[model samples]
Target: MNQAVQYKLKMALTINWFCYIGLLVLFAVWNLFLEGGSIPLWCIQTLPLLLVLPGLMQQRYRSYLWLCFILLLYITTGIVDVMMPTRGWQDGAMLVLSLILFFSAMMSSRWHRLQ
Candidate 1:
């Protein structure tokens, strides 16, 4: 890949990593500590994310594609949570993180192909 493409790919991958890890941490904190949710519920929320970790770590385009699909569920949940009458910052954060993660992951996959 050319220098420009490499730079873009690097940036995309950086953003993807940040948002991906941020969402994972947010989910853990929101479900486990902030919401006092059940362990099973937390696992349910995070298991899919965890399942994709190896592929993501390997920088697989397929993993990024799958992550985008998985993120749709999170984005929908975030939207619903934000619309609740008693919505908290966590809801907004979740929505923002998921959206950012979705786009970044998509771009990462695209950039990977260009590489």
Candidate 2:
């Protein structure tokens, strides 16, 4: 990749990772404080993120591609949550974060392919 595209891709990837982590924290906080969720359940919900962390840190295109697919589940969950009267705000937050992550991942993958 040219320097500019490389820089953009790096920035997008960083943002994507940050947003993903933020979403996890949000979910954990929501489950623990708001929903009285069990610790194991919270961990289980967040564990899939760990699977992608190493690859994301390495800026793997394959990882970015897979993340796009995985993020869809989150998006769907967010939508469902938002549709609920009681959980709308929390789910809205999740939806926004997922959208950001999805955009960044898509950009990173696209730029990597162009490189």
- Candidate 2 per-residue lDDT over residues 1-115, each given as its tens digit: 5889888977997898789889889878878987566788778778877778888878788888888888898898888888887775677988999989998998988988887
Candidate 1: which pairs clash? none
Error (Å) of candidate 1 at residue 108 is: 0.6
How does candidate 1 score on lDDT? 0.89
lDDT by candidate, in order shown: 0.89, 0.84
Per-residue error for 85 in candidate 2, Å, reads 1.3
lDDT of 2: 0.84
Looking at candidate 1, what is the lDDT of residue 77? Answer: 93
Give the clashing pairs for model 2.
none
Tens digits of per-residue lDDT for model 1 on 1-115?
A: 7999899889988988898888878878878887566778878988988888999999999999999999999999999999999899988998998999899899889988886
Error of 1 at 18 (Å): 1.0
In candidate 1, position 72 carries an lDDT of 98
